[model samples]
Target: MAGEMAAGLAEEGGSKIKMIVSYVDNLPNGSEEGLFYALDLGGTNFRVLRVQLAGKEKRVVKRESREVSIPPHLMSSNSSELFGFIASALTKFVADEGHNALFNDRQRELGFTFSFPVRQTSITSGTLIKWTKAFSIDDAVGEDVVAELQTAMEKQGLDMRVSALINDTVGTLAAGSYYDEDVVVGVILGTGSNAAYLEKASAIPKLEGDIPKSGKMIFEKLISGMYLGEIVRRVLLKITLQSSIFGNIDKTKLRTHFILRTPDISAMHHDGTPDLRIVAEKLADNLKITDTSLETRKMVVEICDIVTRRSARLAAAGIVGILRKIGRGNPGDKHKSVVAIDGGLYEHYTEFRQCLESTLTELLGEEASKSVTVKLTNDGSGLGAALIAAAHSQY
Candidate 1:
């Protein structure tokens, strides 16, 4: 068996397995201070926060929130439109809370928490390689996200500096580390999902550098909230064709749309059987057309169940992979392998969460599993952003 991952998150004693390591970890050190703001732009909504920092002693003494819905057209709309909307909303937040000393006598600084994947170059700079999770902002791909936000802020006439452009996972790690130095990894299981962990530079085969104690790593966002509905869609189309669900339907119209969100998946999971296809048809019926055929519903539910099942399993695998990469495996290692989990899918999807934890247990056995703790830490993105603002606060 491969080396036990995350103490008990991976299997042990199966057979000897070969492993190769790659990727660099650049997790930031958790010491600094300043009042700061954080803006989270993820699916459906954008959240803005104003946090007052009190440093390590008083830490994140103040916080506020506002949610902005993306107009239906903007989701499938252009990049300029997407970022522009975010810019405008941020402008409004800044203007509404005018003249806060969070700026520390200079322009205000912020930590932008983005959930999408990026090829990060620095804490504050990264190139958006591609947009997934239902985002098709083609123009924004290959551009520096921090710079984009900077440009947008300038356009909005908001005097702000982006000190950090972090993915939600990194923010979670930072948040975790800020509280407990032992927290090495952070995982988000909301509608969509991803993970981040502290890594040693020497452990990374892909990069050449001395391992910085402050450096850590973030994982891929292959399976997260934004992508689950699409996953269900891909699996359901085949079932729909054979099951007569769309026999009376317009394929052309059905061909172009998003039918499910993570909430639907959560609902199906609670339905006992957790059938995906049934959930899909149920979802389609709710959003698209009238329902009749039993076979159609069955086909949809079963397909949905299968896709959801597979996604959970794969997510566990990715976690296994990360824990392995971080040297957290090995039975009875006794290390406190804390995986701080957040997000909608993991939090709301009971069956999915069970399956993931079950898979991890199977992979990592009793003794090692004892050392592994999976915890639900809600909305660290906002609080963590506040924490960063506090840590970097100049006031």
Candidate 2:
């Protein structure tokens, strides 16, 4: 199903894949310098960073970062309140920087990494299409997210300019490309899943009038971390309804939505004990379903394996689809290329990563597989935003 989804997304008028356009075209070129700020608003926690870049000579001079978790009540609250909360956090983080030597008098330039779907109008502005990953803000939908953040900054009395608005996947690409020119793909496989790749403007039929000088598009919206855990939860729900293997514990835990999170399922799948003790313990601890037999534990692990395997295999297909779309994985193609990957799922889940690589090898075959590599690049989302800010700063 994921492979089908990916393929459909690649097609010009493909169904199922939304294939939304990101209006960003500026990419980092290693020459970006000076002080920049990054705000990564994705998932349950948002991260803020202050980076000191010294062009190509010293690269990153110094960095400081802080993470702030949103209370459940804030996610669905008024947009002004939520962004105001974020602005307050940013103000506190900046004030904490004090009169350090790295400090400059210039107003800060910020790259806002909004990880939801947006109809981008420019490099620095976009309208939020909708919220995903359990976020449902009615007012934020269709509003200019950049303007919202800017207004919040004003309320905080912060002297800053919003230089770039980007998706996390796009930030990953910018950061990865800064380090490796061969890196053409940026993927996030953490709590959610998404990919951003360089697409030729000519190939994108959805783009109208005045194509970018780079003639490229950042393709996101499929094969990412935000939906993987939910997919696993759905499959598990189906299995519990159909099977007696789970036994008669209060179906309460299983009935709860998103209760069986990806990390819990991953820990169980990685358990290698002869009796699968870790799986049993995790099930009992998370679901409160104790008194499980070894056979039942085995069955639970099998279900996890099945779900994650599909996710991994489909991720592989998405990568392959991008390669084929860009004319890389074809016969006689020999140039080496790298796909830079970030996010928790790809980094921590050993089984999922291995399955993804192996499946890629299987699909690309021996020859073409040798020309492609998926390299893990950590913290690209937050840091990439700063890099983009420096690259596209108005100052």
lDDT of 2 by residue, 5-32 (tens): 4444455445445455566676777777
Query: Model 1's lDDT to the true fold?
Result: 0.64
Candidate 1 lDDT, tens digit per residue, 187-232?
7777545567765544334343221221122222336666666667
TM-score of 2: 0.83
Instruction: Quote each prediction's TM-score.
Output: 0.70, 0.83
Q: Give the runs in model 2 whose Cα sits over 4 Å from its true position.
A: 1-14, 69-77, 95-107, 131-140, 155-157, 209-243, 246-249, 288-291
Error of 1 at 63 (Å): 1.0
Candidate 1: RMSD to truth: 7.4
lDDT of candidate 2 vs native? 0.78
